[model samples]
Target chain A: MWHVDEGTMNAYLDGELGDRGAGSGERGAAERGAGSGERGAETVWEVETHLASCAECRALLERVKRVRDRAGEILASSSPDDVVAPPFEEIQARAEARSTGSRVLQLSRIKRLAWAATVVLAVAVGWYARGTVFPTRTEQVSAPLAASELEESAQSQEPGAGSGEQIAASGEPGADSREQGAGSGERGAEQAEEGAATVVAAELDRAVAPADRDVAGRGAAAQTQTPAEAPSTEVGAAAPPQAKAEPDAEVKLRQEVVDVSAQRRRSDAGDRLAAAAAPQAVVQQVAADEPGVPVGGIAVGEALMFEDSLWIAASEDEAQDALGGDVPVIPDLPVIDYWTAPLHGGEMVRVRQRLDEENVLELIVSRVVSDVRAAVALRGIAAEPAENEAQIAAKGSLEAVAIRRGDLRVVLRGPVSTDSLRVLGEKVR
Target chain B: MPTDWAVVYRETYSDLVRFLHRKVWDIDRAQDLAQEVFVRALDVDAENPRAWLFTVANNLARDEARAAVRRKKHLVLLKGEAEARAAGHADPHAESVEERERTDAVKRALETLSDTDRTVLLLWDAGLNYGEIAEQSGLKKGAIGTTLSRARRRLVEAYERLEGGHVARG
Candidate 1:
């Protein structure tokens, strides 16, 4: 009989041999050591049978055990004595602080926007599975996601407030003369917990919303003639009245719902919710002329979208001809891009502009009959409440305001305070 | 599936600290690194959390070692250990001196190990099973036992030699 090697003998001494509660461990060892898990157990038994017959191997086992015991004794002596861990809360708090205020994170402006987006998604998933972990600390996000939070951190607005002012003040797109808008302040720590929750959703569910294909101005980069409709497989998942009460409810947007898992987030819902909550957390500054935020009162803001719309870029005249009327502009805001697309037997003219580097607004125009009002139904997170009848569909920090400009109706929506949306709606002429 | 981070944090924090303490030999520094490990971990849901914590702790300790060299902090490691141990003793002058000597001897023996040997031994002591050690240390499972045997023997011999040297000097 072949004698057992020290490695095998030592394995038996260490209980690493496949004799007890070692099936998987043995198999893992075989895959790692012998390229077959069976070998670990076979080797253990062989060593055992061999040691029983061979005095030499048995003698070696005694020597190995002595060494093992001595080593364990010495190693135990140096072990850190009675180490007490700080509460998990302390670590969580530190992570929040680091994510929000750390220099490295601050340098990545896009990352903050991404993290905010992540938090929205995470919160939706978390809430769906187990409801909100806790209520918002600051006036950031409300259960129905309060507009009062935006009042603290955003440019205040009354219904139909800033149209004339924004139009007169508007010079160019991205000018510093813009609304101190949504998602700009330091909502980092307050939202970091949510960011963690969504990481799973982001990784597991990759079916994505249609990527916005930019066709109007800025550069040739936006001018690329890619497919007008990118794959919108998962984006369609948001539809169903049932979603408001059901954890596994599908997201409802554009009045069409797809069978996307409710465990994942509705991208548009996340976009809107984060946009709604971002202003107070990332407050820019109050523009001197805009009104103060509405304290406890819910602001009734009108919103519109083209339901059966094929979103794309086209010229202003083409848009007007398609809609059988003239498209209006928000006077003071810089026009970043102008897009036109047919909707509900009419046409929609979209004016894309920036509030800041990260916060963007899309001012959309259509004939009143062809326009579908913005009805963002988030599944179970902040389901529709009775007082929220006229609530803008944007979930967190997103706000929408629609106003009638003569024959045309225009709606402005983005990650902004509803008050800001109201003020900008007043500027469209 | 989403990880219940609160449970994982509670279970693994102390083990992470113990593992880190052995690598850096500073309880406070170990605790700080352990906290950082959990902080990063909050953003992720790892399949094997204990293994993940150890892997991160190892990287942090390695970086700390490099940073210490750059700072040129030529700390008398033995003296630091003695002072640390003495600070906790009920009677500073009595058992602490002997405790410090024994600790210094054990630490010196551990230092004699090759990087692979020391890591394997420390990982085992830190509660990793053979499979976890193999996965984390990039060692074959069949080879772990051999490494452990060699590590144990070397540790005992080195400690015995240190004790003998002290006796001869006395």
Candidate 2:
């Protein structure tokens, strides 16, 4: 007896009076489209039965149908003339490329701080490797450079105005000298690939041709870390008169500026992973900036912003002036170049003295300061003093000896025995 | 298993473009918006992808419209230049021009309807049946019929009003 509503009339007209499927609703009027289910059939019967008798309902349905048809016809006129969606393969390519691009952008932004960070890493790792990597090299190269070689080695020490001082003079471009210490732990890197251009080979031969007999007289500090390293060092030791490293032995213990740079370039991955070994902050930064780049990629960038806290100077005197206190040295080892990043209120200063063209000695003279917050701590650096030996944990591969002389802590890093390194530490005291 | 988007793309592409073309009022922009929808679709995990696509497409269209309104003056100038360029083109078929005029008339009619009414009408036109329309428009399933009936009546009346005005002006 009740009149059918306008909605029912339109529903019947549009042929969409349908029930849902499954737990209902996500399916678009699913099932059989129009009036399909038992519930839908009942609605259809009720609407139709009402329409059969009600002339008013039929007229109303007729009016709605005309309006609907007119709209459908009008909308049909605006159908966009043929559109082809881009191939799915193209979208997939875009996603991959975009993912790589975003990582690059992140690294680019990081470089603003990262370039400076590399220098901090270079110095800090040099300091840390003195403790950890040295003990390992001392075990490997220690016996060769015996106690007798210490005096001979001391006389052999010629910290000349080498490339480091020359660079220091020219506004102290920190990279070349600083990076010399960067991959010192990888002294055992595999020899440069053979068949390098003859011109490059000739230059490296001349450059790598440093006094190896003199270095061996200094001791076999360059060999025996790895089997791969042994062959190159043997080549250097065997070819004494020719210095060391021929077109084959390219292991210049005094890293050929070009060879060292090349070595730095080659060992970049290993160095960054090794470098990423500490200070918590650098690891977090690297992880945040480049999720794709292994979390350890730039941990080797060891320096912290000594801004108001640390500053690397151009000259030793300038560093001394900045320290406002005496910067200790290994006496006769002419302080070729020293850069300082003032820490714990100028309580510490790092002196990088060239032991030979092949070695760098990092003498960190710090007056007893409470704060040990220098980013110099690598993973597993033993802080405890064992008997009378410097707390030497064989870290990477750099040979170092740390001796705390009363209030002063002197760390000596080079390719020498713990005893030989102690002699160097002895000179500093 | 991941949704086979390629299958959905091929099936719904034409309808999506047609739907976007009405909202944006430009064939090129409509196709671009449709591609954008699919591009974003690739990243999401939609249980009901078809419904998800249209919903995202609708929101994107609204955002595009808001941006278009801010750039309306610039668009008016661009439209003038486009009209001039079209006028200069040599068209031999009069039927093509008549088809364009009819589309313009329909576009004008669509712009006059209230947003909800226009959305209800367009959702149905874009091939969403009653239940989908009700879900998309947040209307009761039964009320979708009533909403569509009202929307269609207004749309036709608006078109006739425009047609009569054009006849008078001519």
Candidate 3:
């Protein structure tokens, strides 16, 4: 006298109630009724038995059948106009556009990255030299000239700033130099030996600018900083002649400064406060406020707090300026902050942060290069190749969304949905 | 081995577009999105192309929905202007007002169901059998029949309610 439930009755009507005889109750019910000629029949036998005596369930089945019929008719009646297939040509063009757009974006990203790295290294060299190279002369220069001419001087000397005295002078501020000179006058030789080692550490920053053609020369310059090297081989001797020979060096210096500043403009103004000068204040504040942790090979210096209020305060113009006229295609997001460092073979690592509506920070890590072979190389221990390279995959607890768009291999991480991550990944370039 | 992308595209394009058209309400957009699904598919090596297409198509539709929210006001203004243009001249559209009413009625009916139920019903309508619908919808195969039955019943009830209102107004 057991009657089938509504769900079972529905399954019975759809012929989906195949006999799951692993269940004892279902098996007993099937055994009590029709012998197993058909599995579907055996599964629905309980329902069939109830329907033979119960007009209520039979009427319900009839109603369900009618409803299903009407739904089918309505759906089928949709005009072909409502679902016209796009011409194959249009589809192909769209496909080509997607592929080409990604390629173009990647190429553009590589070029932009080169420009960005050039600017960063130029800025570091410029700022480092201003205090040490010609401290008194730099103070007398006009502000605009100070920014541009000083940068040119740095670039010219960049090839040969290898003397231990100049290295110690450049690494420390003007005040620190005077104090060290006064305090360590008796130990001048020992101080010079230590300064030589410090100069090598500063060369680490030089390695971050891959696009710079003088990488080999810079490496040579670093080696020349050894105290063992004769004072006669000081880079200052080579700087004056090189500056005189490269007249367009000033124009190049200005252009590099303009390009670098423009890219920095895409991020928040709070971050821009650090870019114009040595950001000694910002770096010091960050160091005091947040402890550094190593992620991958790089040390994440500070946790940039993502605030919804500040995010809303960001204007559209700044974003456009940062991207250098190519607007960030991602809607309602501004690049909050960014960091760039060099990778091997004329490639650079670019990290950008953007906040979602919920104020969760999404970090986009990209290698701006023409080839993503290095990016794919890191995927060796990944579970399996996804359907496509861009598809999101779970590697351990972290979900890594890797996209090889043009030359950029973008990996985005955050507490966002996969769809959001996908959109954000596409916008990295 | 996975089916050739060209073969999968040819076999599933129409059904996929139809399913998307119901979700998006614009044939051209649905078709464009359909092509995007295939373009994305070029990267995916799926065991079941049909299931993959539907899943990707669903995600694309969700993205479109988010974007549409930003354009809703602009669309409302365009709709008003179009209606004003239609009033000034005899409507030249091939379908009569009654046909538009019936189409809107079906849309409203489908809209009444919950997301899973509606998705199940639409996938079923798109010619995916119970097992296929289960894979696409992330529902169990055995439960798909129950889901379908419930969706069909609700859809009919909603349509009948709308029809009753139309008759009353007339």
Candidate 4:
């Protein structure tokens, strides 16, 4: 049988002696021999024989027993008070506080967003109501005549025949004279008047002349022509009363022309007003369509007026179509009130000039708040300057301006004071 | 059914700390590590609470020792200074009650030889016999005799040196 070694002894004491303890066959046989508790057990016999014969080995066993006993005693005597524990309650409390704080912060953020949405919704509804309520105030006035009416009036006043002479000589002019002559000659005055009125109404009902047609074509061409030898000969010369009434006729005609001109001017002005108001309405409409954009306190500034180059290039209908179906053919939006907070830097004030989907320009005003002290310290300066130095530096410095637009809101920062903000409110178009 | 941790803590915390103190040289650190082991045990599946507590305490001591070795490598100067301060603080009380405790710990360490040897000694101290230790420690029954003999020889050698009036190196 193989003798036990120190490595094997260590492994066995450590309880790592399974499967690979030295000399498996001999060890198994020795275990069986010892297990029987026989007086002459093989393994016990060998160990006892060695202990009796070898003094060194026996001494080692005795020492091992003493050592084991001492170790047990030390382990038993050791006390529990030596170790410390972490304060778990404090950690748990801190964790709970952080969780509750974050939840509160999240709730507040949601509340703010909800308020902004409500404001935007109210503004959009108000704008739409205003547009629908006032219609006549937004369209232009035009004279109600057509081209066929003028032609019918001209045809009824035929001249040159003896009958036409009688018609012309009658006290009334043109169509009125024709009606008077027809009654005195053959027809009843009532019939003639009815016929004359019908013809005149029909003539007035004609289609409007093209705008390109000259004014001269509107007058009686036959009256302007003269027979040979009479350059300025007067017709119906004996009727001095008629001749005296000519100035009145001229005055009446001039009055009609002036009235038409004034009406046209009013119409043009109304159209321009409507055109000017359109983009503001469109911007409001777009803001309403998007659910997230803030509407309340969003003061719309005067729309920068530029003639739409594409609209000027194309016909009105094409321009209307290109702008999208939602934009009406005639847009009549009023100027919306808007404001932008200015960003103030040392001696420079910045304001937001314009805002669109993708671009923004800020107006920088220099030295606007020249007397006010800065409320906060400048970034990147480690030690705060002394009180005196701060006072000297505070001489109303304008800070850098930033113009920012996000998914929901737009902001402009500069040196604009509260008074300046109020003034800006008045100036918005 | 699992054992209740609150009961386990009430019953075994003192014993567990004492057991860990025997394993680790530093009693304060041992107590701290033992408390951590109990806290962990509170979360463990408790089929056998006592065994689990013992196992976890042993593992934590082993981990602490490995960490100490790593820490010693990085901050050698700091460690040496700390040890010196600790020794200086203990010097006045060395001949008093603390000295007896220290001697007892040294004697126990001498009793435990290799890691395997110490484990077996500890299992035995826990009142497990050779057969039970074979099952707990995965040792074969046949090899226990010879292995114990060699382990005993080493333990005796270690004890004799301590008994021979040799001072322990700090």
Candidate 5:
């Protein structure tokens, strides 16, 4: 008697090995496993005789049956009718579309490669032509130039005819040519500074408009002072002749512009930082009937110390005045006593104080931050799952919780119980 | 004698789509591939039309499976999923969240199996006989049962692991 392999036994269990034309003995074994009666009774008797003795194969068969049954349940749930294929017309249209799409994609790829190659060739040709067409200009000679030559050179470099006359009239023919070059460069630098100062002042004025008119006024004064200091500095530097006046003026103007632009940039940057750091206020105004706790604004970065008894409180009006906006209020909860105040940062923090019968106080301070992800890595709290959101798990004695609510993240820190923390977190609208 | 093409189309179209749906995970794509099989079948004269149909459908599915692998950066597939949802193409039979999740878990589990195992399991689920599946899969007719057994065990294990991940994420 040939022994049945595990695969044959498994197939027999699935009722899949019934008619595969195996050896008569193997077929009898499969027929017995499939529970086929009457016609295969002799075969069943023979298979059962083997099964009764082979404990290992019988146990393996039971395990295969369990897996097959479970998988069968999963497969049966996915009905063909559950997915209604589009009408035949749509299927035909899609097949045709796919055929056409592949052709179009191939053509488009070829077109793109050709266009790219052409663009590269055009860019290469343009760069080479630019190098040949525009050769570098020669330096000016120290020997005094005739008025016409100076005018031509000055007109080419600078459109201003006045600059040509200054160089021609200097009368000193052997003045270092390098000095003249330096003077021209200094003047160009000065003009650039003046332009930059004007733009910065205009931008600052626009940036600070209406909200801080005083800041805009200072920015405008700085703009004007930058160009104003340039001329006097130039006069002192080139005292030889007024012909050198332009260079001295240019040098001074350039220096003043740099100073003013740097100051304006720093001021602009500070204002931007302040605006960005302005805490996001999450407000739940106190219920009119209950009036549980009054909310007040506290200065930014300053923590209000509570001695477990004095409990300094502020009304909504006081909080608004302090925070420059409406204050976020903490909801009343049974297990915890709430003392609320606005922090100077854009966020409002609610401190929950739990007082035991012995008068030992536990403090939990929570606030909204712009991002919860940035604060998730605090020293103690690990993230855990809560309903609809995730909460930070408390480590040992220190309990900290942070949950994201829309664009803002509400964080809680203290020894508050998990239930109390979740209750408060949900209250942050 | 040539086969009756209309009779063959009428008999085989729905099963072919159902078979492809289990492979592709998208009903629209399955229907398109099924129709494409018929379009190719218009040119063939086979004595065993049913086996021939399965063979050609398998080839088309294999080609698409390879193409999908090559196009693994799924920005297009993500956009397609979003568009499909908007168009109400999601599983209509899912009655509850649990059922939908189970179906999704099963689909993901099927993805983890070897291509042959997945094909055999899906073909069996689509009501293919062992002999027909063997013909389509190029496995011996007697070996189909063994393959099905291995495929079922692996699928259940993969599915359980995926369900565990969902719990962890939650």
Candidate 6:
């Protein structure tokens, strides 16, 4: 007969013994006999018979029972809780607060991005307006005066005359009269030329004339000469008394034209100076707006118009020079549209081009600097026609608000379905 | 539907806290960790709230035990001169609290016997018969008589040592 080992007894205590106990010889035989499938007197009798005959096993069983009882007594007396638990509501509140805090933090980040976009747009608009208005006025007032000066220099150099020599001493480029024949034959051209000459001659006659008699009376008789008539006939037609009356007026008129011409030249020079300075200012502004972005090239498309200024497209080299370095040149960017507006002190020209399949690139140039400052590209697919129409009709709906703020782009990419884009647009923006 | 954490907290807070406190000796740490366990339990499916709570509480106790071993190494390093100085500066009331904490540690160590020994002992103490013990513990009915006898001897040995060998066996 095989006896139950200490380890087997321990395994029994731990409840790990399964069918292996059935193979342990006589004890197993007795257990098998006791398996009556009934919790009755017969089973107890068999168990008692086995135990009463086995003195050593009975002593072992009694010892196990005593140890089991002692251990239980120790645990029962020393029960775990003398301490209390914290309020359950407090923990629930903390979890809820954490969830809400994270949501608030996400919303705040979105708000900051919106504010940044607003600031960028305002600055771009302001910069573009500044370029358009001032330069246009400067161009207008200056060009006519320069043209008049050229005409005066040409008239001063009549080849044969000492008066022309005297006028040539003024250092004007057209002071040598080499083309007197060209001035005479074409009737319409000659008439226009003669009209300008008459105005100049009358002014000269008035300057040499005496101050007391009326210069206005002499000037009225001189106006009767046909523009097609010879310059000598017009000069001879002027009344001597009228010519003698307005010497000071002639000098004043001559001085006024010269000063106007000179002022225009100065303005042109100022424009060039401003143009030279504009790129640096634009770069500085762009840098200030987007720190750490290295600027390589600034280019504008030919169709660009910002406010009243017209911007012609620039070549890669010109754009590189403007940007101060060679940038990743995207050549032949298709022109989408232009915006013309009066702003700042000149014309503002903004040229938009499609940078890629998804992005629209906008380049803004100021007429004053003729320099491009910002180049922003909007990225994402254009909304479907139906969606756009719905968006428009939804006007002031949540969907419209989201599209206006570019939230629709994020919604489109989110796990939410395409339809959810419309819903999110309506709800979140 | 989400498991209602409030209801779970109300129903099982005391029992779970007591269960954990028995496993982990520090009442405050056990209570804090028990709340964490409940919060984790709330994520489980609601149909088995008791089973989920038991599983989570068991996991938390096991994790705390591992952490305690790590803490013991660090404490032993500080316990030499630095701890002596710290203890010396502590108030008399604080000293008494430390003494009570040490006694608690001794009691907790006695509770961590093997599952079979613990169950067997607990069943016997509860006055279960050999047949009931076999049914509860899954031991063979024939083996329960022998297993209980040995478990009793081991408990007596442990108890005598705990009492400093002064208490005589009845």
Candidate 4 local Cα displacement, residue A398, angstroms? 46
Cα lDDT tens digits, model 6, A384-412, are 22233222222221121112222001111
lDDT of 5 by residue, B1-170 (tens): 99765577777788888888777666677887888887666657888888888788888887777645423322222235565354443565556788777767878888889989988988887767777888888887666766888899898888778878999998
The fnat of each candidate, in order, is 0.66, 0.54, 0.37, 0.16, 0.33, 0.26
lDDT of 1 by residue, A143-192 (tens): 12333333222122122221211111111221111221223233454455
| Tens digit per residue, CA lDDT, model 4, A355-400 | 2232233332222121011101011011222222212112332112
In model 6, what is the error at residue A289, expressed in angstroms?
23
Question: Against the correct fold, how does model 1 do in TM-score?
Answer: 0.42
Local distance difference test, each candidate: 0.53, 0.52, 0.50, 0.37, 0.47, 0.40
**CA lDDT of B86 in candidate 6?**
65
Query: Which candidate comes out best when scored by lDDT?
Result: 1
Q: How many backbone clashes does candidate 4 have?
A: 40
Model 2 misplaced regions, further than 4 Å: A19-42, A85-88, A91-429, B71-96
Q: Which stretches of candidate 4 lie over 4 Å from their true place?
A: A1-429, B6-11, B73-75, B78-101, B104-112, B127-132, B141-153, B167-170
TM-score of chain A of 3: 0.32
Of 3 and 6, the candidate ranking higher by DockQ: 3
By DockQ: ranked, best first: 1, 3, 2, 5, 6, 4
Clashing pairs in 3: A266-A322
1 against 2, candidate with superior DockQ:
1
- In model 3, chain B matches the true chain B with a TM-score of 0.86
Candidate 2 per-residue lDDT over residues B8-57, each given as its tens digit: 88888778888888898777788888887887788777877788889999
* lDDT computed for candidate 6: 0.40
TM-score (chain B) for model 2? 0.83
The DockQ figures for the candidates are 0.27, 0.21, 0.25, 0.07, 0.15, 0.12
